[model samples]
Target chain A: MIALEVKKMKKNFGGVKAVDGLSLKFEKGQITSLIGPNGAGKSTMVNLMTAMYPPDAGKMIVHGVTLEKWKSYNMPTYGVTRTFQDVRLFEQMSVLDNVLVVLTERGVFRSLFETHGELHLKQAEEILKRVDLWKKRDEKAEDLSYGQRKLLEIGRAVAMDADIYFFDEPFAGLFKEMVKTVVSILHELKNNGKTILLIEHNMDLIRELSDHVIVVDAGKFFAEGEASDVLARKDVVEAYLGE
Target chain B: MDYIMHLSVLVGVYAILGLSLNLVVGYSGLLSLAHAAFYGVGAYGSAILMKDFGFSFLSAVVLSVLITMAVGVLIGLVLSKFDGDYYALASLGFSVIAFGVFLNWRDLTNGAFGIFGIPKPEIFGYKFLAGEPYAFLVLLAVIFTFLICYFVVNSSFGRVLKAIREDEKALQVFGYKTTLYKLAVFVISAGLAGFAGTLYGSYISFIDPGGFDDLVSVNLIVVVILGGLASLNGSLLGAAFFVLLPELLRFVGMPDSITGQMRQMIYGLGLIALMMYRPQGILGKFRL
Candidate 1:
């Protein structure tokens, strides 16, 4: 089943077309890796789909709900959430709070009356343990190391419990053990039948993890298919492989 | 004894002001200089309601706080569009505008003549006319404000404010309408500041446009920063220093003419030194 579909999306920054007339499909329960060279608009596509930046023109159909315009603040309510290319966590907040906040009461009336209780703490801890961050649950996010910050960001996204998770470079920099932890988390998420869209450069990891690959060049589609088939394309090699 | 009671009441009122500003500057991370404007609105609103309409103390205060909140929301909507230094400047402009209104809107505010003969707070049938009794009342207000700040900051709603301060876009992606959150804090802060204003107006039994201006707003901001950004106790500590330091200087025997100028200079130097040595302020956890 299709989780999200993008049709004729166009976005431009100044004179540059970041994402130009791009049409794409994200399937449910599948890990789709978006691969491209530098400035291939991989991240821009995520921005447009997530409504971080409004597309000059586009249509996003999520679970058959057609949306001509997507408001960035409505994503979580729509059951969509994303992680940043640069890990963005509440720096001053405790590691546990970073996750608990996502699960906390969101409505103003309820927020004032309700507090973070045992259920919220238990869930936050579970997500933290999944990322092996339960030990540092009380530490501020800014004090975490580079790799830990990435894990925390992932942990926060996991805490959101959103249906569609767009991870922008979740595995860019990490130790082998941390990478394994993330790989396991993603595998578990996939096993749970969650839709995952990842933007990554590591071909080996892409081959190992991705169920499908979509290649883009200069803000336009280059090729897309099964990992083996798309990665074998001559144009994809010329554009992305720097051949 | 009366002198000390009066001084303590001043501290209590300023402490309430500090806590109110801290909610915006410390917890929510918005540097707002327009706090005293809301403070003034509360004072003037209560003063007018009670003096002209013969309203009870409780009714007047509640109405003034509500009026201040309405104004706060209007200003917050505009301030929400700007961030960082721009946000500060826009707020400063609002403070200036509010001051202008207070100074020139004579028909309501009474302008330079100021409002006087404001009655003491009377609840039920008992009138709180004594200095110690009023001081106790002010202390109660301080405790109430502190408790509200404590619970709100510790809640998840407060966590989201910190998140917005860190990365607004990221919070929005998580489906948080940052504008509403910002506005909420702004209105709450304003309402509390208005409460403090009412306390001040009732305590002093008089108020003027001069009491709420750029200098007063800057003084409140200074108290928030010095006590420490994002620290509730820092607000109390800041209020202590802000309210008492000048009073202490009055006894230094320096001429009153130069004393005012000298005290301001000292405050500037102290702030500069604090920034150099402890940019985080005395107990600040976060730095602007």
Candidate 2:
């Protein structure tokens, strides 16, 4: 089943069309890599999809239901979660608290009295261990190394347990071991029937991991298909070199 | 003994103010300058209900808090549109407007003459007279406010507040209605400030528009900063220090004319030193 579908999505910032007439679909339990050169509106597409910026015109259908007047905060309720291109972790909070915060009850009154119980602790521990940050769980997020910070951000997304995970440049500025760790996480998420929309620049990693590929350049669709076919296209190669 | 009790009562009142404002400025990372407005509303609201309408103390306090909370919701809705320095500026503007109303509303507030003859709190036929009885009463209020702040900061809701403080946009992506959280904390903080105002009015037996001005709000911010941002104990310590310091300066024996100026100088210099050395405050874990 198609987990998420965007049709005729358009967004503009003054004279610049950040994301214009973009349409894409991702199926459940599949990994779709969204690739483009710099200034290709890749990040803007993710932002629009996650409702961080309202599209000037479009329709977003998730789980066969059309979302009307959806907001950024409502994305999680619709089983949508995302990581930023620049890792945005709760810097003053501990690694464990970062994950635990995502597991918190959203109801204001109920959460006012709610403490993190054993189940929350267990879930947090599981996520931290998976990210290999269990030992640094007590350390403040700001104190973590860049790669570790990236892991914590992903761990936070895992704690959300949402269906569609938008990993925007999740592999940026990471060591080889950390990259492998993230690769395994993406695979694990896919195995569990989660839809992953990954925005990445690494051609080899995209070729190795993507079940499907979609390319955009200057806020418009350039090419898309199997990763092997799309990456080899003359126009697609020129788009990257042209930039 | 009476003097000590009076000082203790002042400390207790300010402590409650500090704790309430801490929720907004410390945990939620919204620097609010309109706290004293709600504080004034509470004092004026409760004082009027009891003195004019002959309502009981408890009922007056309850109704006053509700009224202040309603005002808070209205103010919070407007404040939520701005962030950082703009939020602070807007809050200061609201506080100025509130003071203007207190000074200009002659019929309801008695104008610059202020409200007098605010009766001491009476519970179960026992009047909490000034001095020891009222001190004890205020002590109870301090403890109550402290526990409320403690429970709130320790809860999952508090965690989200800290997250909101760190990065509101990121928290929104996590499915938290951040504006709602911000509004909730703002209203709660306003209600608590109003509660403190009620306590102050009853203890002092008189309140003027002079008591709830923008300067008073700045002093409350000092109380929070000195005590420590995001630290409950810091609020108490900050309030105690704030209330006691001027009294201590009395023994310095400078000329009476310069004495007030001297106290102001000392307060300013001490805060500057604190910021330079320990910006987080005495017990604060977070620095703005």
Candidate 3:
């Protein structure tokens, strides 16, 4: 079943067409890799889908419901959540609190009086352990090393427990072992029947992890197929090589 | 001893102001300079309701807070469109406008003549006269305000506020209505400031536009920054320092001719030195 569909989306910045007439579909319970060369509107596409920026013209259908006048803050209610291309953790907060923030009550009045109960703690602990940061949960996010911060960001995403997850350059600066941890997390999300839209530049990891791949260049679709098939295309090579 | 009690009352009033303002400036990272306007609204609102409308002290305070919160909502909606320096500038403008109203609104506020002979608070047939009784009333108010701030800072709402301070955009993608949270804190902070204004006006028995000017809002900011940005106890400590420091300088016995001017210089120097060495303040976790 199609989990998310973007039809003829258009976005412009001044005279530049950041995301001009783009279209794509992401299926449920599958890992789809969105690959592109530099300045390919990959991040812009994620932003549009997540409602960070309103599209100039397009329709987004999630779970067969057309999104009309949606906002970034309400996207999670639609079971959509995303991580930033540049890791954006609450820096001064503790690692545990970072994950717990996602589990907080949404209502302003209820949240004002409600303390994080045992259920919240248990869920946070489970996510922290999954990211292998349980031991460092008490440490401030700013105090964590580069790799640990990435994992904590992932742990926060896990706490969201959304139907669709957008991971933008999740493996950008991780060590080999940390990459394994994130790869496992993607698999776990897929196993739980969550739609995964991944933006990554690492060809090997994309080939190994993606059930399907879609390529875009200069805000337009270039090619897409099973990962192995599209990555080997002549046009895809030239686009990446800038030939 | 009476002088000490008077200072103590002043401390209590400023403490409430500091705690409330910290929720916006410290926790939510909104640099609001219109706090004194809300403070004046509370003072003037209660004063008018009690003196002109013949309302009781308790009802006056309650109604004044509601009125101030409504005003806060209107101001907060406008301020919500701005962030960072623009937010601070807009809030400063509001304080100036509020001061203009207090200064020129002749029929209601009596213009520059000010309000005098305001009635003492009467609870359960017991009138709270000046000195110890008023001091005790303010102390109770301080305790109540402290508990409210403490509970708010510890709850999930406060957690979100701290996150909003760190990165509002990022928090929004986490499914938080950041604008609403910002508005909530701003209104609550304004309401609490108004609550303190009621206590201050009732205690003094007189209030003027000068008491709630932009400079007063700046002083409240200094109190919050000096106490520590995100700490409840820090607000209390900051309020104490602010209220007591200049009074203590009197004992230094600078020639009476230069006493007032000298005290101002020393206080200014002290603050500069403190900020130079400890930008985070005495107990602050975050630096402004």
Candidate 4:
């Protein structure tokens, strides 16, 4: 089932076509890797779909809701969440608080009176333990190492429990252990039927993890197919190799 | 004892102001200089209603807070459109505008001469004239304000505010309306500041536009930053330090002719030294 459908999404930044009339389908319960050259509009496409940037002319169908323009604040309500490429964690909050903030009730009035309940703490602890951040839960997020910051961000996204997840370079700068932790988390999320859209440049990991792959070059759709088949395409090699 | 009570009342008033400003500047990461504007609104609102309409002190305070909240929402909406330095500039503009109104509107605020014969606070037929009794009233106000601040900064709402402070765009991706949270804090913080303003005006039994000037607003920000951002206890400590430091200068035995100037110099040097040594502030986990 298509969890997200982008129809002719177009975005331009001052004569540079960041995402130009590109339409694609992201399937439910599957991991889809969106690969592209530097400045190939992969991140732009994610921004457009998540409503971070206004599409020059495009629309998206998310969670059965037809949106002519993507609205960033509406993403979570529609069961969609994304992690930033530059790790954006609540720097002053405790590591536990970083995840707990996302897990707490979203309602304004309810949140005002409600403390982090036992269930919320349990959920936060479970996610933190999964990311191996439970021990550092009392430390500030800024005190974490670069790799740990990335893990905490993923942990935050996990706590959101959104049906659709967008991971932007989650494995970048991570150590092998951290990478394995993230990969396992991604697999676990996929097994639970959460749709994952990853923007990554690691060709080997892309081929290994993505069930399907969407490739873009210079803001245009270059290729789309099963992961291995698309990676083997002559055009895909030339696009990456700059031949 | 009388002198200590007088100093305590002043410290309590500034503490309320510090904690209130800390909410907007520290937790929400909004540099709002217009807090003094709301503070002025409360002072003038209660003064006008009580003096002209014969309203009770408590009713006047409640009405003034409501008035400040309304004004805060309007200004907050406009300020929310901008971030970082721009937000600060826009809020400062509002503060200036509020000050201008207080200064120019002679009929309501008595203009430059200021409101005279402002009524003293009375509850249940007992008048809080002065001395320890009045100081206790101010202390009660401080306690009430602190409790409210504690409950808010500890809740999920506060967690979101801190999240908003960290990265509003990231919070937006999580489906939180960052603007609404910012605006809510603006209104809440402003209303609390206004409450403090009411207490200040009644305590002094006089008020003028000069008291709510940009310097006072800057001092409020200094309290938050000096004690620490995002720390309620820091607000109290900051306020005490700011209020008491000047008084301590009185004991330095400097000549009365240059005592004020010497005190200002010492205060400036001390702040610079503290910032150079501990940039995060005395107990701050965050910096503005």
TM-score of each: 0.97, 0.96, 0.96, 0.96
Q: Which candidate has the highest lDDT of all? A: 2
- The candidate that wins on TM-score is 1
lDDT of 1 at B183: 91
Off by over 4 Å in 2: A241-243
DockQ of 4: 0.82
Candidate 2 per-residue C-alpha lDDT over B122-219 given as tens digits, one digit per residue, 9 for 90 to 100? 99999999899999999999999999999898889999999999999889888888888889999999999999999999989999999999998988
Q: lDDT of each structure?
A: 0.90, 0.92, 0.90, 0.88
Writing each residue's lDDT as its tens digit, candidate 3 over A114-214 gives: 75567899999999999999999889899999989989998899899999999999999999999999999999999999999999999889999999999
* Each prediction's fraction of true contacts recovered: 0.79, 0.92, 0.84, 0.89
Per residue, candidate 3 scores C-alpha lDDT tens digits across B177-200 of 888888999999999999999998
* Predicted candidate 1 versus true structure: per-residue lDDT over B176-268, tens digit per residue: 888888999999999999999998998899999999998899999889989998899999999999878877888877776787788788889
TM-score of model 1 vs. true structure? 0.97
Please give, for residues B1-288, the per-residue lDDT of candidate 4 as tens digits.
988998898989989999999998988888888888999999999988888899998999999999989999999999878889999999999999999999999988988899877798988888887789889999999999999999888889999999988888878888787787788888889899999999888888899999898777877888887888888888999888888876776777655678667756765676787678876568777766
**Model 4 chain B worst lDDT run, 10 consecutive residues:** B259-268
**What CAPRI class is candidate 1?**
medium
* lDDT: the better of candidates 2 and 3: 2
Q: Write the per-residue lDDT of candidate 1 for residues A50-107, one digit (tens) a residue.
A: 8888899989999889998889888887789889897888898889988987888887
Better of 1 and 3 by TM-score: 1
